[model samples]
Target: MRKGIIGDILHGEAAYIHDLRYQMKMKTGEGVWRPYHLAKRNGNLYPTHGLGPVAQYMNLARTDDQFNTIISYSTPAIGRNKYAKKISQRKTYGINRF
Candidate 1:
């Protein structure tokens, strides 16, 4: 079961935690567009942040445990779009395009 859990994580079986903590207020900063743009190109922006420790603990690629495959899913950016519309209406952040 433990091994399976680790495998699941390595195979992209977790939701991204960045949006949970990164509020719309934080997006108003000047340089905040970098991550948003990068995230646009990369489906999962922080896979290493979430998976690195697990892989290290499991000794993946160093021991018997290894990655067989990897998968990730990108949900619709509904929350972000809604928030962007609100911000755009206010013209507070200059995030018209989102």
Candidate 2:
């Protein structure tokens, strides 16, 4: 018969270490969102920070492969509607909301 003890001794330690590391990162303040914005006309990706680990994740200056392209457009009429609401609110408050 094959010994089950042999397999447990070999693989158990590695499984325990992996779980410990994952838990530690979770306990510490390690993850947060970094904002990225794109202009209405230009299709470009803008990250708030550069260099180090974030750069590796975002893939800046090495390759453009990391970026997900987005396209957007707004007409003059859309601008007018936005402006109208702002003006109305501003007139009521006697100050600009933005």
Q: What TM-score goes with each of the models?
A: 0.53, 0.17
Question: Which pairs clash in model 1?
Answer: none
Candidate 2 stretches with Cα past 4 Å from truth are: 1-56, 64-71, 74-98
- C-alpha lDDT score of every prediction, in listed order: 0.55, 0.29
Relative to the true structure, candidate 1 reaches a TM of: 0.53
Question: 1-98 in candidate 2: lDDT tens per residue?
Answer: 02444342221111111112222112224311111111122222222222234444444456654435433332333443354355444222211222
Question: Which pairs of residues collide in model 2?
Answer: none
Candidate 1 lDDT score relative to the true structure: 0.55
